[model samples]
Target: MTDHPLRYDINLSILFTELPLLERPAAAAAAGFTAVEFWWPFDAAVPDGSDVDRFAAAVEDAGVQLVGLNFYAGDMPGGDRGLVSWPARSAEFRANIGVALALGARLGCRAFNALYGNRVDDATPEQQDELAAENLALAAKAAAEQGAVVLLEPVSGAPRYPLRTAADVVAVMDGVERDAGADNLRLLFDLYHLTVNGDDIPAAIDAYASRTGHVQIADAPGRHEPGTGNIDIDGHLAALADAGYSGWVGLEYKPSGSSTDSLDWLPRARRSSS
Candidate 1:
């Protein structure tokens, strides 16, 4: 990749799992990255304020910008995609937004990823969709207090999860915006997930580039770094650039080998946009 056009941020959660959470930020900085993102940093939805302070310190001490963060989505290691639509855990999800935003605000981050959880035995599809809309709307409004936006994405590999296509997420965003009268909701253009769901990447970017608030990537067959799979990662990035998406492109893929070694495809000079 000759002078990659996009401003790329390392996903601290996935890329540096070998290190402790607090250490990942510095590792990313050592790798020449100026920015990073993560899933919820704590197991608890609302971590203690001291813990929140520590989380903020780690990022600040590392000298890297925290560009994105996910609201708690339940036990991620246990296969829970999210709790945004789970009726049982709705309260937990809502309570975490303020803490997430405050922590994010400390790091100058405004884009938040809200995963749509797997289908729960307690709620029907209709009921789940309804709750999702309400929670998303609520989240959007909360993020708005600080001029942030809530990002919704469709993921693959979870058979029970509902939002598996770009269109599905877009529809939910549409409903949330129209019904709840919120405008801070936007699509998370994660090309790897869309490709796994068999969506046309070019068409998706063409249709929703301007509506996209964030972008993430990995390759299919195996969710590894680019060039290890068949997905045209660079070409898709080019297309995104052509479509005028001049935002952070998150490196959210599992490393093909050691995390540091996996970043070979991306030049160090291009790692830090500044």
Candidate 2:
């Protein structure tokens, strides 16, 4: 088996809602984790509880790395409703990307996740793809300046968004690389969504692994943990290895029981070398 790094998103967004951000890393370490992640840290500010400096200190104290940061949600005040697809919201999207990069820097994270939010009815598929490519190219140029890369995730079942296939992501990346002249732009392949969108997970991974900088997982039907649902997660991991993937596989799933209770499967997942 090829060597691969195993970094999970302690997903503090759901795991420790009761605990403060500065305290989540310690909690994750106590659970036998050496890395932690969250969805967004927009609210983190200076001289306060949610400050990223405090979070950085916490991670250093615990000797854990901040593996990933997903900045997908755009519901904040004055924020854009959707990124990439909306022409009117391009400025807002750029500003958000800047914030995400700064936060990643503070938390010692090198990766930031961008979303292809809902598509627009007025825009054709070609138009949406073009817009997404341009936005990602711009973001990539800025992020590369900061020593970070933007990982785009495609979500289906949502109307108006552009990315749905591995091809779409590839096209976007190609456009970004060509326009921005930077090869740091990449994709974040979520196995659960690939299953939902009817992609052959292993085949898709093999095809796009070189461009995939990060991954997320959950089971089908309910999007729960690996063993509790129907996804062939072990096989997926093996495929990831075969495809030459060497990044973190984030546990971005929801828990059926309490987060701690569902963590029983963590050891098995961590132990599996696939």
Residue pair clashes in candidate 1:
82-117
Predicted candidate 1 versus true structure: per-residue lDDT over 68-118, tens digit per residue: 999999999899999999999999999998889888888999899999888
Point to the candidate with the largest TM-score: 1
TM-score of 2: 0.83
Worst 10-residue lDDT window for candidate 1 reads 1-10
Q: List the residue pairs that clash in candidate 2.
A: 118-160, 118-161, 119-160, 119-161
Q: What would the per-residue lDDT of candidate 2 be over residues 57-103, giving only the tens digit for each residue?
A: 77779766776876645653444325666665666676677666776
Ten contiguous residues with the weakest lDDT in model 2: 41-50
Scored by lDDT, the top model is 1
Q: Model 1, stretches more than 4 Å misplaced?
A: 2-4
Per-candidate TM equals: 0.98, 0.83
